[model samples]
Target: MPSHRAASLLLALSPCLIAQTPASPAPLDGIWLGTLHTGGPSLRIQIHLHQDAAGKWTCSLDSLDQNGVGIPCTLSSATNPIAIDIPAVHAKWSGSLTANTLDGTFTQGADMPLTLERQSTMTKPTPPATPDAALPPADATTIRAILDKDLAAALSSGALAPSTNAGVTIGVLAHGKRTIFTYGTAKPDSVFEIGSISKTFTGLLLAQMVEQKSVQLNEPVRDLLPPGTVAKPASGSEITLLDLSDQHSGLPRMPDNFAPADTTNPYADYDSKLLYADIAHHGVSIAPGAPFGYSNLGVGLLGSALANRANLPYNDLLHQQITGPLNMTDTSVVLSPSMRSRLIQGHDAAHNSARPWDLDALAGAGGIRSTAADMLTYLEAQLHPNQLPATAASTPQGKTLPAAILASHTIHADVPPGMHIALNWFRADATGNFWHNGATGGYSSFALFNPDKDFAFIVLFNTTISDKSFADRLGQHIAQRLAGDPAVSLAN
Candidate 1:
């Protein structure tokens, strides 16, 4: 789950247009408004098109409901059927343009109908206020009570249906104290897929390697690939480890060659063989180190490259480097028998049973699974890296775990609007808070912490609801409460 506010601008335009074309295409300049039928709530979408004196067109998008505004988008064409691409979210839209309306479908993972009517004048809404910087840390008891009440209501109302084994587990760390709360069937030790949060672990591994001088941030990723394997974009430079971690590697969100045998377990059969073949056959079109584009392929390739350099499997390297030293026994891509017993069944948005993802070659992207207890431990290390026990290994250059942790959290790139990227973690410019969210077919998780306030929050849910922002909103609201800020409703 990327920031709902940041990730909701999923509009893209394809080249396919309606057969009929206007004899003289109308100017696309000015504001256009529409409603996106996303299967649940209708989202109001606004698009701004500008034509420069040079006759070039530029575009931006706004998802009003999600508070995503001024999202830069690529204007693919200015012909009869207008085309636009939002590479950041791997989405596109292709519509036939008319005098006052643009009719098209928004395509990301699915196609949804959208119609934009030209607006003569439009006004922008004020953005939400940032969390105050000077508020005191929130009280744990109050936070727990609010969360308990909200979770109970959600379950009782069938909002979290197929609830037989469904529940949520929350962990908070404030002022050096730790607290764990469970609602419904979730327990402190219940196992759930942490999804993209695994990227943070992979990022830490990259930092460790960099700290040890095993690799340079600017080193070309191809250098570490197996012999005879080639990974290069059609133009520009080769992708680097830093570029991959920061999501600037220009790789698409996913490989076009990916055709899963089992839609239920999409990544299960996608092994290294297919991954390599795709890279060689269909190299990236954009240059490396380009503007931010979320690329699971890029990070997955990075994990494979690093493993090749170390002469170890990705999971083995992960354990030896991060989880093993941290003693996060419950965290790993390959679960042990003990972990399997505690693994909760995942559910789709509709509350139907969903299979867990395997993520074979792409384990670096979103594969690891763990319990709330383990995640809190991981977060604790991040908060107070210097306090980690002496048992944790240090880099060969004598760089300690604390140094690597700080390196991973160092801001490296911008993620539009006001968000910044620190390795796989997202940093809020206003609050200096670091956070990341993860979602798989059946689960969603959120982690947020502010070092200045010495506070952290982690939320894990057993199902993926229609509203993707549920977990993230819950975590942020708790953080706000802990900071002594005004209490906000946790209703979805």
Candidate 2:
């Protein structure tokens, strides 16, 4: 590369160059201080700014929590305003920079959009320099301490519950293996109920059967029901697994058959008889593949129908096919003696005793239990569908189950807002983040993994809510935080 003429000339004419240098540099190019407000989470930062002769410029931000750690990014349009993208965190900062104020929107993750303003003492940013990678040595320690302190603060302030608060655990997987950075429960082996997260299991099973030509995605669900099943509706025959997986089966979030006298543990009272009766009278509220209405009934009915195909009980098939092969020793519909001992106690907001739950009628929908360790392993399989252990151990000229699981976990239908539904997993656009969340009687759990980044995380707690809004908010918050959007402060 040729040296810049201006650079060479400047060295030859140092005195003249100094004679023309601007006495006062542009106000925008300096070491400036600011705050990143993510609504629920906020961070203080130091930003470095730089400009080129051609007007091209770059901006970097370093977080105080990260102890002035900086990351490089292109500054979009700086002529009349300013913009910044922290790719590492997927945070896009944009705003108008006037003589006195800087106003713009900062987007972190999926929880909610945040509007940020300059702190009262903010100053112009300094010339850009090579940004730091990790938090400062002492600040790294401080980050951990701050996390605990903030967590406590949130709890005391009612944003988080003491014992039953839902929290996230980050895990890393490498070379077909996994390691947990931090697990909530004292023991790394403890299991938490995986609630609707179990839907992926049913979906995987359905996809597996479909891959084998045993079941068709578009085939009517009616074909898979047990013989002598009841009926009282005209559109029941139109429902299909595809519809269920896509959340467009015209089914309600749950079934009317779920007459839970006790709202605390809703699914506990729903029986198999009621499930069968309801399906028999299934009158789809809308046309298949229409609007998306998240329905637990759709997945529940799908699981029941899948069990029917193999003439095996849902739990038996669940274990025999997926859990057994994966060696998920602790995941099961029924808790064993050893598992019961390892079970973490569920608690409410007051840290009071919470009831155990059984999703009998919809076991396939929300009746699985797993540890953070096992979930990492499961996520790994999804991330690396081709390199599954089953594939390596496959017998030549014989069938291998791994291929079926891969096909099952791939996107099957589109949901909304850059999301798509795979068999039992959720696809976060093309990011290759496949995930599912589970909530039992009193416990709520979230699991997500990105195939591209080799990153996976889980958030499990002993508190749950029947309120859909709360659950969605909690899930999105955990997801945003783990996906490197540090703007997500608390799990609350």
Q: Each candidate: what lDDT?
A: 0.73, 0.56
Q: Write one digit per residue (lDDT tens) for candidate 2, span 57-104.
A: 556565544333444444544644455544323245565554434445
Question: Candidate 1, 250: how far from true, in Å?
Answer: 1.3
Q: lDDT by residue for model 1 over 320-387, one digit each (tens)? A: 88877788899999999999999888766556677888888899988899988888888988899888
Stretches > 4 Å off in candidate 2: 1-170, 174-177, 181-185, 230-237, 261-264, 284-288, 390-399, 430-432, 465-485
What TM-score does structure 1 among the candidates reach? 0.82
The ten-residue window of minimal lDDT in model 2 covers 1-10
Candidate 1 lDDT score relative to the true structure: 0.73
lDDT of 1 at 68: 63
Q: What is the lDDT of residue 223 in candidate 2?
A: 74
> What would you estimate as the lDDT of candidate 2?
0.56
Superposed model 1: Cα runs more than 4 Å off: 1-40, 47-61, 65-136, 139-142, 150-152, 158-165, 231-236, 282-289, 393-399
